[model samples]
Target: MHRSVLPLVRQTLGKHPAMMGVASAATGFMRQMSIKPFTPANRRREFQLKDRVESLHACRTQIFKEKGVGELPTIVVGGFVPDATEQVEFQRPLFREYGSVYYLNYPRHGFSLEMFFAQLADLIEYLNARRQRPVLFGVSFGCGLIAQFLKESANDPNLKIRGVALASPVLCTADLIRPEGEKAGGVRMLESNLKRILKSAAEGSEGVERQIERARRCFQALFETGAANRALTGRHLSIRKKIMHVIETTPADGGYQRVLALQQLDGPRDGEAVFTGPTLALLAEAEDNLLVPTSPTLSLLRDPERRRHLFPRLSFWKVTSPEPDDAVAHASLIFHHHCYNPLIRSWYHKLQAPQLFAVI
Candidate 1:
């Protein structure tokens, strides 16, 4: 949180951690229970994905097929803090029209970041073996992992990825977790406050609530839903609640270790400017909160001359809100697929076309 708002949260939620946890738990429970998760059921293709080197870092995957989308499936590595239950929502609009997508639920109990990345590499190879090269779509931290995966496989003559899409990319954990000095501003309260909330997840129940509430508070501040927040309270509550639910349930160590794991990957060496094959960076219009141009990921993606030299095929595009009033947010990458899907669909088609530079 910005140093300015910390005192307010202290005054309102109080000094005691339990009081803080209990306060948000009640409302979170009500809201959480109110919106039931979309069950995969018949649409789901469930299976356990084991790591190559026999590690306990395997993650479960569910492939949902939209009837008649064909056998070519896209691998979607979603960002942190989402209710693992709502796996189906990630498919809407994006795959609804015509596609198959598989979602990975990161090991919730305990796992290391290196292990998980290795596990993701295993999953990609596993899927690639069975079918055609799978397209990759990622949001937030998931995007960071995708970038790492590409860097890891950069030397391979035959990488099987069909295409890649990244939204609200969080390429560095060190920058996000640390407090921002006014002299070196860019870290938003939403991103900084996450360090503390995510840490709470490692503590268990009370920790979980602390994680949920602080995350909610961060979003409230991000969207400016409350008087305390200096930003605009966006008009999209339905979307806001869904984003909150993501924070409430994502895989932590006890579950929280995921944060530390990501920190482990400071991201592809700034010097290793090796850009993968066909890539698309989906950016948000507004910055300073969650994503800023100066941030590592955004900066890398935004530089045209640099990308032209290194990541020649990498293209950049911005997504607008689904609703006129609801602005595009950090979490909206998966949540607001309507705006994103068209661009992605277009990008994929362009990647396969004879001329990659075909206009959208």
Candidate 2:
């Protein structure tokens, strides 16, 4: 009973209104239960702010200072999860030559999309105030946030972005939840199923808790032996352990909420029309089973009409491995240093020479 199957089951049971209501109620209760009270450890490791900045949703900002000569460009990394500090730190060296890297954990790993956007806006303003136009590097779900930010700030004259690099971007949430079929119908089915589940499970608090526990177990099992874990090869055991820790510590309720938020996204089409800066989208060569498949991403970035219309200065790269054993997947893309480091460096060099864009 992998967590991936939950959506499928909800889809299949879409016709049952009673069951959908029950499931929905149970899911909401579980998410509420997942919220943990603030602790000192969270402040120390998770939400370590670099400077005294006004809090957005009580989230403390963390910036990794770079050791280099002269004022280097700043690189702001939007992490996938609140505990994404490790992921951000791992890529610090890659951007060390370019600029300082920074990341902030969400307040208690629970925030609405609007709040998240506000947090990003604050960070962008903080950098801009220092006369720094940062190169945004968004990993996983962070990619969606970055895309939305780009769209929202398109008209802001003060916000000058150097470039944007997305690694395994989760552009659309519906693609991840709904099965391969009619997109509209799939969304309706999911909604119906959720309502039915919530209604049927609208029992006393204890009963709902029991049902939530059952769902949690199913999700845990899915992560243990699911497509998402398939990317964790022996070479990436360390990363795998960190991922498992995140799964174990973070509540599935919050994760699913994030997924729901992503499902509502339409990507940065309108913003892309106005965004003339350099953009880089990195996709895994192999099929991504964890989140949405890479095909849609490739289609979005590779389609000539869409590319020309959306990302005029887009550089799309499909990361591949010569050896089957060394193949990279969605989760492993961030850890694939040998591959991404050079690619990022090349892109940074290109950004440095704006005249090259005119020549091409």
Candidate 3:
């Protein structure tokens, strides 16, 4: 093993500790892994659609089970990092509590948009028939999707979305500009590389294996950039190590945008009216340091007017310790530690807790 590269993986995963463990567990590409896909009584289905404006040619949806007479609360997981292939790990524990779990892969990587949208509609309808409200959990692109759904459902009272949890939620496009914002060098590099890979793949300039090679490099580049950036900036070693590990194990061929659509992926539109649900906003300590926590962004849900106008029920927490060994104060719904480790139980429970209603 490239011991020198371990630092990169540690830093990246350490910064986003909750995701570190699962990401570390992603030892190889999804195709090579023997783990079976989640199956509902209905099994899973895939769909494809074309987006003329975005030039998004495809999308997909995977279901674990079919609808039944038994009513179980559904938990939806959507957020795919190319390095994090085993997304199931994040929800398997939650599924133990919730009746069922459903996972969606965006158009850029696993499934296409048309498939994802169609399957989501079907799942929502199925849940309605059973009188069960599914807990929507989304990270990054999925966060935006959840927000859009909430906004659209504002008029539909029957929409059975009971709760929403946005982990490391991408709230603002500006946030991407830096490791703290959309302009972050790592993100820009990954985006540019993806566009190039997509162009080549679409041209059929190479065989399936070659296309996969391009994808693997893209994922590696993203992870490496993140790790390198942290190292240069003198950030924590855990984040850097995690990033390195991700780059090391991530497959050269597995596509991510196919899993998490990048074009459709936009941070919160600037100046858009704030929207809310039973929302838990997670902020990483390193990220907070990179981007100053101002009133506008920090007050995402604290202001009464904003809370009532957007999400009447909103809570916020800042993750201060990305290392479990660090003697520091921990907050509710905020996790700070190594991702591959089990430091997120409290944070996870806090997000899922029913006690948040009291704050709302």
Top candidate when judged by lDDT against the true structure:
1
Measured with C-alpha atoms, the lDDT of residue 301 in candidate 3 is: 41
How well does each candidate superpose onto the true structure, as a TM-score?
0.65, 0.64, 0.54
Would you list the C-alpha lDDT of every candidate in the order shown? 0.56, 0.54, 0.46
Model 2 per-residue lDDT tens digits across residues 267-336: 6453256346788877776534444333355456657667656667778787776667667656344445
Model 1 per-residue lDDT tens digits across residues 160-244: 7777777777777753655344335545675655666666656866876567556655654543442233221111233345555
* Candidate 1 root-mean-square deviation in Å: 10.8
- Misplaced by over 4 Å in model 2 are 1-82, 179-242, 268-274, 288-296, 353-360
Tens digits of per-residue lDDT for model 3 on 286-344? Answer: 44422224423435543555544555566555555555554222111212233411333
lDDT of 3: 0.46
Alpha-carbon error at 302 in model 1, in Å?
A: 2.0
Q: Write the candidate numbers in order of decreasing TM-score.
A: 1, 2, 3
